[model samples]
Every structure is written in C-alpha cells, then in structure tokens.
Target: MRDSKLIYYRSGCHSANFTTWLIMDVIVQDVNPAISDLPCYWNRETSKSVGLQSTRKLSCLWNGVDVYLPFNFIKNYFEIFGAFSLNHGVKEFDVSHSNSRVLTPSSRYNPREEFMHFASFDVEGRSRVLCVSAGEGVPLSTQWNPQGYFYPTQIAQFALAHYSVHSQAQHRENIKRYTIQLEQEDTAARVRDEDTNSLVIQFKNTLEFALSSPHLVLSLDLKINSDIKTWFKVQLLAEEEGELFTLLYTQSGIYIQSDGSEFQFGFGNKASGRWLRLTRDLFTDLKKGLTHSNDKKKAKKLKRTKLKVISLKFYGSGNVANISLSDGEDLRMFLDGANWFLENQDENGGWPSNVIFNQGQKKYPKAAEIQPGWYGAMCQGQAISVLSRAYHVTRDQKYLTAAEAALGPFQKPVAEGGVKTVFLDRYDWYEEYPTNPSTFILNGFMYSLIGLYDLQNISPDNVIVQLLFKRGMRSLLALLPFYDAGSATFYDLRHFTMQTAPKIARWDYHTTHINQLLLLATIQNSTVLSETAERWRGYMVGKRAPHN
Candidate 1:
C-alpha cells in the first residue's frame, strides 16, 4: 500500500464524500530558485536541492489504479511533499479528509484568475503527503517582503514544517475552602452578638475573608429596621487595595457599587423590615465591573492576585446572618458549558446556531450571503476542546463519545448539509459561517484546528480524527498567507466574495488572533508563527507594516 501512488482528490460532485483517491503517477516539474531568499529556518542546502521555489507546475501520469487511503495513513504520516496541483486535465479533487462531502466551489473561486503562485513538489514517489497544498504557494522568506508585507501561505508553510504534536494541558485543580474573619474598624460601631450566625451591628464593623482562588461566591443575609433611615451598607474591602465594592440595602433600592474602582450596578427596592438574602459571584462581578470601569490601571490591577476580601464594613443599623464564601465556581461554569455541548449536540454531531446571520449581506452588498441554522467550525472545535477537558476531569466516556460524535457534520459538505467548504477546489476549510460564498474566518478555523488537536490527544487511535486533524493542518498552512494584510489580519476572507474593502479585525479580535497564533506556534514550534504573533501584538501599540 505504501508503494502505490496515491492522490486524494474531490470530484466536482458536491455530494461525493472525501473518500475517493486515484492511484496515479504524479510527475511535478522542478522550479529552482536562489537559496538566499529562502526562509531563515530552512537549511540552505536542503532548500536548494528541493528547488523550494513557489512557482512550479505538475504533470500527472494518470493511472486508473484505485487505491483507497486508510485512516492509518494519516496517523503515521505528518508532512506533505508536493507543489500544489493545478488544472491538469482532471476534475478538481476534494482532498478534505473527513468522510463529509463538500460544497461545490462558489462561483467566487476563479480558477483562471491571473495571480498564480506555486510551492515545491517532490518528483520521487516518496513525497511529503502530510505537507501538501492544492494550489496555494507560500513565500520563500518568512520575513516580511520589501513592502513590509507577509502572506498567509508563508506562515502556513512555516507551521506545517514545525508544528509539534502534544496534548492539551490538564486543568488546574479547584480550590475547595475559603475562610472569613471579623474585625471591628470603628469603635463608634457596636456588635450585639459575637456568633457568626447572628450579629447586630451599629455604625462601622468589619468582616475579613481569606482568598486563595478567584472563583469566589459570596452570600449573606441582612435585615434592617425603619430606624436605618441613612442606609445599611456592607463595604467590601480588598486586602491590598482600598474598598472594592459597596453592597448597599436602602429603603429606596439595593445597589452594588465600586468605591475606589468605578462601576455601579443597581437592583430594585427591598423592604427595610424584611431579611434579604444576597448572593453574588464576586470574581465575575468584580471582573466585569473592572473591565467596564474603562480605567486601564484598575483593569491591569484586576489581573493581579484577587485581593482577599479584607473587610465587609457595616454602616448605620443592620442584622447579619448566614454569611458564606466558597471557591470553585469557575470550574462549575466550565463544566456547565461542556454539559451544554453534550445535551445540545444534534443527531448529526453538530451544535447548531438557530439564529440568522446577515452581517455579510448587510455590510457587503456584493457578498453572496446570509442563512439561518448554520453550524460553525469554531463552535464544533471549541465544544470538542471543552468536552475533552471535561472528559479528562471526570473520566466520562459520554463526554468523549459526544466529542467523537461531533465530527459528523465535518464529514458532510456545506452543500450537502455540512460545515465544510473547499477553497479553490483544493484547500480544505471548515467554515465558521457557511455562507453562499465561503467566509474563511481566521480565528474560527484556527479554533477548529485547536479542538481537533485536543480530541486527537484523548482518542489518539481514532483514524477518522487523525485524517481530519492533519488534513486541516495542511490546509491551514497553505491558506495562511491570504489572511495577512500587511498591517493587520482580516477577520475573514469575505473580501473574496464582497469585493469590498477587507474587514480588518477589531482590536479584540486582533488580540485573539495573536493569542491563537502564539498557541499554534507553541504547538508547531514554528518561528514564523511566533514572529507573526509578536508582530501582531506590536500592532496594538500603534505598529504598522510599511506600505508598498
């Protein structure tokens, strides 16, 4: 089986599964280039011998030998060794690894488009199948071109060569207990009872809680009489900082306000004479408040160790009881998200988005757009990642099974009710939004790849997953250069459909791209990935690529 010539191609028939492999002798023409321009990481001799120029064409020796690609081929192999195949008298082959059928190339894909580039291909039968591309060509140098511009294909090639295989890190153990202590700050205040279960305070009295982890839940019950005309307030003080939050129960209403910090949230009126049970996730509330505070200093400080709640000072008159603090609510939320995937996944192994998306149609009049009930590659991939972690934590076969099942829609085509589309009839791409014209979203595709990595780690022997992951990786490597826009990254390749200005990612999405690239860099050990991440990071601080 190893000796047989194997070429995986997609038929023009959109409903055909990606299972067809034609046994053909592929003879690719060698295009030699100067070694001085090769990426710094490439061995010059190796680059020279391979003729690693990005403008080679292929000559196919089409033999009708029908040899199927076993999933194990993907398991043992990890590099592709060919210059991209062009229009060589054959129907465009859909090499997308999943058994899923793929959408027909949208009319947007111009096969005869003028701008054509190619990557190197091996003439010997022992080609790098894992490092394959369809028609996309990576740049020779990993560095920016003379115009300070780089392309996705270059970054993709860099990742394909260096990407490492490793499992996702185990989740950190959740902290179990947190202790609270009491302190009387103002002598003007008096406590009627010393017991934690029952306390009546006047003026200012303080309660201090030790903090180990940030996933904190704070709950307390308080009662105030009509005599509290001024207000009964619990001032939450952090250990290192000034007062953090003010929990106030007034005759008018209940309010959560930041003191030295700058956020305020109000809840409607609570009757004075009744006991009020107040429960809050302090970490979430504090994080949200601080983030919206729009004060960078406070926001930066929030990243530091969450200060122990040093004091909860009481003002005016109030009775306190059943005060409690607990840790590990964050993990609870994480598990909750995973459970949602388990419960909500469709029979087709996809999580469906019921809402309609018209953003492309609304923004770009030229875009072939909008649809309801689309399944996103990002959702599938991220859910799998979450479920993989959940499986690790609980050792639940169900979570693993659900994750495995989620690969279903990936095998089908967008035209045949799937979340995948082939770019230019060659590169495999999982669509975030399955629009009429493909929107090759950068962040979503990367996230889907990350999820594949996680699933592959737990179920290492799953052949289907192996092919899906490696093929997706190969496609991503070849496709990277297209996402690069010199100064910033495009949110998606919608410009191909819209024919409008490229949609530059917002600062937040730009940061997400940087973070995702950094992770991929660590996975691939690719200098190109790391450099691109760093360069994108610099953009947030006003850096821009020099225009041609």
Candidate 2:
C-alpha cells in the first residue's frame, strides 16, 4: 500500500445467526519496510481473519506474479493508516457494511465558495467508505496524528497562520456590513442596519483624539420613539486590543461604567416625542480616566492609551432609526445658549425673573398664575457674565452691546431698575434690597458681584461699572467678618441687623463664593482678597491651620 492510500479486508463468521461480512481496503507506501515482517492470525471457528502474527509472508498472485504482503499491514490496517488518511486531507471518515453507498468525485464543491469536498465508496462484501478533501489550493494536510510523528511547533504555526487569516477576513466583512458612510472627517463612521432600524455612529480612535483635542465636542441626535415617557438605553462601546469597555447612559444623566462605577452629569434632560440633542464633555474626561479613577497621575497616563470606539447604540422598544456624526459644539453650545438669553432679554435690558411652566398647573393650581417677568439682581448679573463670556469667545459686538444694556438695571434704585440698598457704617458697605426684612442670601449677592466683576473685566473704560463693582466688593468683604473665622465659610443666609443667622452652608455656595473672591482678587490685584481665598481653599480641603 502507498503511504497516502488506505485498504481494509474482512470476512463473515460461518454462524447461522451471523451471516454478514465486513471488509476495508487501504494502501500505504513511503513507510518503514520493517512493517512487512510482523505476524498475522485468523479465527478458524468463526471463519474470520483476526491477528497478524504469522511468520509467513502472504503471497498474492496478481497478473501471474507473486506479491508479498506485510502481516502488520493486514492485522492493524484500519488503525494506523486510518489516522494517516485523516491527517492527510480528510475532513470526515466513517465505515459501515449494511448501509454503504457510492459517491462520485465530481465538482460537487464550488471552488469560489466551498472550502471542502467529500466522497464515499461502496465495494464488495457490503462495505462502505467515506473520505473528505480540504478543497483546492489548501496546503497538504500537516495535522499531527498518533500514527505519524510530525513537529508540533510546525503544526501549531500553521494553525495560527490559518486562524489569523480567517480572523482578518471576518473583521473586514463585519466592517462592510455595518458601515453606512465614511464622512469627510474620516474620524467617524456612520453605521445603520435598515432591517433592525438601528444605527451606530462610531468615532475612530476616540481616546487618542479626545486626549489631544479636549475641546472637541461629542454630540448625538436622539429622535424620541414614542409620546409616552420612557428611558432609552444608550450605550458607548470602546475596545483596546480586544479588551472591551462599556458605558451605559441612564435617564438621570448617570453613566454606568463597564467596571460597575458610575458618574452623573446634567448634559441634557431625557424626554420623549421630540428630537433631543445630547452633548457631553465627559468623553474627554473619560479619556483622561478622570471619571474612572481618582488618581490624577494614572488618569493622565490613561489619556495616551489607545482605544477605539466600537459603536454607540441607542436601544429602546423602538430601534435607533438614524444616526449622524459631527465634530460637536464644545464651547459653542454655551455661546448659543447665551445668545438665546440675549434674544429673550426684556425691552428693559434684563431677562425675565424666572421661567414659568404651565404644565405644573396639573399639580399646582396657581402655577399658571405665577408672575413671569420680575427680574432679580442675581439673574441680571449672571446674564451679564454670560454675555461677557460670549463676547470674549466670538468677539461679537452684539454680545457686548447686550451686556452693556443689561447693566442698566444695576445703575438705578430698586423703585427704578437698580437693587435697593442700605449703607452700614460699621461694615463700610452697602446691603442689598434693604427694603426686604428677611435674611440676606449670600449666593444672590455674591453671584451678582461675580457677574459685575466679570463684566468690568471686559469693559475697563466704563467708570460707572468699575465703581459699582468696587462698592459691591467692599460690601462682600465687610460681610466676610460675620462668617466663622476658623472655617472661612459663611452661613447660607446672613442677618442684616443681627450678627448671626443659621450656620447652615452648602458646598455649592461655598465653592461658588470662593471662586468669585478669587476672580475679584485676580482682577483687583488685592493681597487681602487673595489671602482670604487661600484661607477658604485651605478650609475646604481640610488643610487649614488652627484658627488664631
């Protein structure tokens, strides 16, 4: 038998109940010639060939010539060469005596699509055979088997190469199937599945891009699926060397990270039935690893990590119908919002006191009766600060003009447009809205001062605005002595006549107040204000020395 071929032989036992016979054929060559010398055996009572132990070499007369056959080959023909055949090219092999059928070797396998072929044979004695081919152009099977010894490293290398090729092909197909358009930026890919009505917009190399360009915006357009309020699951998928990271967006603007960590933000409120715009500065924060961990050094290292965005999936009962990609709004969103405030400003150069929600009338009957146009000092001050920022960013004269106009209210008395005040000789400062009998809200006063200061920074030539800002700062400093000296933190609201009120203080108000004081210190170059800011900072961070 040739090394690449196989053969089998069998005969039935001469028993009345067992009349069936089985035979198999195999041919093997290029093997050790010593295999021909083993013994063979037969079972006389059963009339079946069994062992290969005989010293005699069986002679077969073929075309009048005697042929010597190996006893080992005859005895264990199936085991040794069966494995050899399997290793060579066969994908499958089976043997049967009663149900054997012949299969012709034709082009049963298409070369373009099919990667394998199979064949079956039925010889005499009701024997059936099966063989498989690994298809055209495939390398001669080098698979290791017990019958044949081969280099394990060689086999492993071949298997790995095959797998790598297969994996690359699969990756290409996946990209083709999911990709809808590669836009001009080349950084983003828009993918849509029409059948599922789903869309995925992916930003390629998200971590790298975000780290270098922290100002870049990431935006998504969410078209509501229904009128009934529901929370749609928004998912961000990212991968690095096959390691996956996921972030889930929940209704309350909470982001649940892949490692079970969570962070919250107010990017936008989730609502139904209208096209909602979602924007986040958190992507840059995420790339920096600031949201994932508290260690600044580790977070900074993570900024350089290579991570690719796999997809962004918005899933609800209804699938994401469409997705579009853009470079995002960044600070421009703030600019636009400030412009909205500018557009909605009252003719008297102020924004409405508060936004009224008629929908709240369902729960509160007088919700609709709430007045809509009574502007407060805090509101006008903040509006001035926003306009100043807008003007700084865009260099738009319109923002500056609007800001100057908004300052009109603070120039006059409360009976007019300005906030009412009373001068305190002890503090050498003016108290705001002195006509009111209630406690003085620190946020309302401090925030208004911040806005005025910010506006003054931009309009240094305006003497009236500068004077008003200095007066407000003096009042703020005078009020500072009433706060606890040890903490350098004030109560939520302070009494006008009385020296003390509730000791309650919120971190939000504390931080905002400290920041405003720092801004004032920077603008005025005042050592006193700077020292005060440093003291408050030390207090907030628990690093302050024992108060003297």
Please give each candidate's TM-score: 0.46, 0.39
Model 1 ranges with Cα > 4 A deviation: 1-324, 368-371, 525-548
| Candidate 1, residue 446: lDDT | 84
- Tens digits of per-residue lDDT for model 1 on 425-532? 987888877777777888888878877878888888888888888888888777777877776678988788656578987655776677666666655645777677
Model 1 is weakest, by summed lDDT over 10 consecutive residues, at: 114-123
Tens digit of lDDT per residue, candidate 2, span 116-141? 11111011001010110011101111
Clashes of each: 27, 23
The worst-scoring run of ten residues by lDDT in candidate 2 lies at 129-138
lDDT of 1: 0.52
